[model samples]
Target chain A: MAARSLGVVGARVVVVAAAAALWELVTRLAAQPYFPAPSTIVPRMYELWFSGPVTHVFLTDDALDTFPPSLGRLLVGWVAASLAGIVLGLAIGRSRVLSDFLDPVIDFGRAVPPPMLVPIFFALFRIGTPTQIATIVFGVIWPVLINAVDGAATVDRQHLETAKVFGLSRPQVIGRIIVPSAMPKIVAGLRLSLSLALIMMVISELVGSTSGIGYRLMTAQQNFLITDVWGCIVLLGVLGYLLNSSFLLVENRILGWHSRARQNA
Target chain B: MLEIIDVTHTYGAYQALGGVKLTLAEGELVCVVGPSGCGKSTLLRCVAGLVQPTGGRILLDGVPVSQTPDNLAVVFQDYSRSLFPWMSAAANVALPLRRKGMDRASRRTAAMEALEQVGLAGAAGKYPWEMSGGMQQRVSIARALAYRPSLLLMDEPFGSVDAQTREDLEDLVLRVCAHHGMTIMLVTHDIDESVYLGDRVVVLSRSPGTVAGDLQVSLPSPRDQIATREHETFVRLRAEVGRLIRGNQLSPQET
Candidate 1:
């Protein structure tokens, strides 16, 4: 297992290194002001991220505090969306009446393009930070909610009967049997939601925010600071990868018994 | 004591059970044997309160069974379904106790104890998919035993297992019931199994099912599979059950 995982990690490292080398080679060959090589961008990213006056300039003003405000808004909006979606999904999934009543509404909402809602949110909430967060929340919630409902609704009938024979009350049955059985699908839904949430966060910031990586990317484009724009893109990629990996780790811990059996087979 | 007094069940317009009556005394292991689609399952479900009797009443100690009673548990034939896939064997056994207000550690201990009773103690940490078909059924049995139900309802619990595993499980069940003083109602299609495990075997007719015969097994207890199969009384009882199930009427003494 250790060797297999190490090989996987090595393959990822090689792919990332090859991509970076290709980008550097292409930029060096073009030698354009718009396209900067990794050698030029890497030092700049390191300085901006860790050791330079970019932090002072960016951190001093609340409107210029890109990293913290963007991260904070992302966490808050994502958490709210997840909690609401899971609760609503479970309620709808467990009841035929609720599922029938809400199915059309959910289908319609999910059908609407997430990014297209930005203008409506901007117009409604008037382009503030809260509006940006709301846009992310609105865009990311449906996948989680839909998947949660599917997961909860598809609980094995025999397990339900087993719970009944054991004399479990309705609530006890839901908590002890339904939730655990539905977890794998729920985790899959959360993974999709996490990626969508990140994308929505960047889009909302790009459209209106005074601070955030998205705003920084836009400003760097206007100033022709190509390396800084590339730096922000790299940061977003790393952030997204970290979020997904952490979620996978938690999922593995909770579902170790299932995965372990699969491995043995 | 358990009683199914003239119980009848209908699904839409089709009648499943028509006035089925049966009685089981304390510590009695009664097996209900019948042809396929004979509503033997319907009778067990009515007694378990998984389904309601449309006409007559089922009573446990004189109280009518409208819902799953507290001191009863069922072991279903599809072991893969009866045991939760997401849980460990011990956890599945402990599940019925979640509503009984016991602490988690105590539930685990009780579950392990039951698994030990079923000779599956080493498989306590294994998930349902990790175990073989027979072991999975044993896990289901362990779950029921952990609940310590007064009346145990088994609906073709060995139907999915191999013949060898079936014989072993049948003997194990007999031993456990005898030791626990458990009153059991087992429904099966196997004629010999009905004679082997049951103290009394009740045979049911085809759908709109009704009782055809109820014969007492006078075989000695603590039965060994090999020796019991060779016994004259066992041979006679099996033949009698086979004939009754085939709708062939024999004399009372022959049955």
Candidate 2:
């Protein structure tokens, strides 16, 4: 099992490396000024992270390190969205009355294109980063909330009865039974929400942020600096991958019993 | 002692139990035999306080059973569901004791003791789904025993297992009841089982169910399944129970 998993990890590494190489080759062959090769982007990514000049890339002549502010906003907005979505979802799913009332509203909110909300948020909040963060939070909360509610509501009736028979109170039942039972579904919802959060983060920054990877991308586009645009894209992709992988690791750890049971069966 | 007085239960418009009366003395194993949909389950549920009698009362050691009495525990038929799937067999057995204010280590110790009684000490760490149907049912039985209820109610506990497992479970119940001095009320559809397990077999009539006949078994205690089946008294009791359950249609002279 250990050897097989090692092989799988090795294959993933190879695949990622090959994909990056291909992207670099394609851009180089096309002679696209906007698409930076991996070699050019790697050094820039390292410099941006560790030693780049601290100034707005658009406003300044030199490289403006922007990874920290972008990462910080993404983390805060994503966490807020996740917590709100899960709590709301569990409440809505468990209560038929609330779910019925909120269904259409959630549906409408989810259906609206996230990018279109940027202007509305900017107008409402004036020119602050909170408006962008709010836009991302709004975009990401729906999926997590919907999934959580569905998961929590469908906890096995037999198990619930067993808990009642054992004299578990409402909170005890929810904590020890409902939440654990609903975990897989909640995890699935979180996965969806995570990706959406990343997309919303980038979109919000691209449209309005004075500083962020998205702002750097926009600046690169205006200046026709293809290498810098590619670098920003690469950085965003890496960040998104890290976010998703970390969530998966946590999910695997918490749900190890479920996976083991499945394998045994 | 447990006394059920003129119990009647209704589900919406349908009357399930009507004027059912019964009593169980301490340490007595009474089996209730009836056809499907005859409200045998309803009677058990009423006793367990899982369902309230629309009219009448169930008194356990003199107090009316409003909710599940502290000294009562139930073994339900669906063992897979009755035992929490996520918890280990020991944990499932220990679950009821959470209400008793026992600490975690004490609960674990009591659960292990119960599992040992049911011949499932080796399976303490296994999940319910990991064990066979018979073993899972034993875990459920172990759970009931761990609770140490004065009045133990089992609702068709072995209904889901095979004949071999059913017989094994029946003997296990008898042994546990004898050892622990548990007063058991077991509801089953099998006539042979009713005779095999119960000190007294109570037969119920058709829907809107009421007790038809209650007969005491004169067979010896610490009964062996194979030897007891061949015994004259066991044969006679099985025949009498079979007749009684089939609407008691035979004339008294014929019986």
Which prediction has the highest lDDT against the true structure? 1
Q: What is the C-alpha RMSD of each candidate to the true structure, in Å?
A: 4.1, 4.6
Residue range B131-195, candidate 2, lDDT tens digits: 89999999999998988888888999999999999889999999889999999999999888888
Candidate 1 lDDT, tens digit per residue, A1-265?
8999999999999999999999989999999987888898877777676453565753334334678878887888888898899889988999899999999999999888877888888888877688888888888899889988998999988788778878988887888778887777777788898888888888888877788878888898889888899888888998999999998899899887667757654
Q: What is the C-alpha lDDT of each candidate?
A: 0.87, 0.84
Q: Please tell me which predicted candidate would have the highest TM-score against the true structure.
A: 1
Best by DockQ: 1
User: Which portions of model 1 miss their true places by more than 4 Å?
Assistant: A30-33, A52-64, A123-126, A261-265, B248-255
DockQ, each predicted model: 0.56, 0.40
Point out where model 2 deviates above 4 Å. A17-29, A34-65, A123-126, B12-15, B248-255
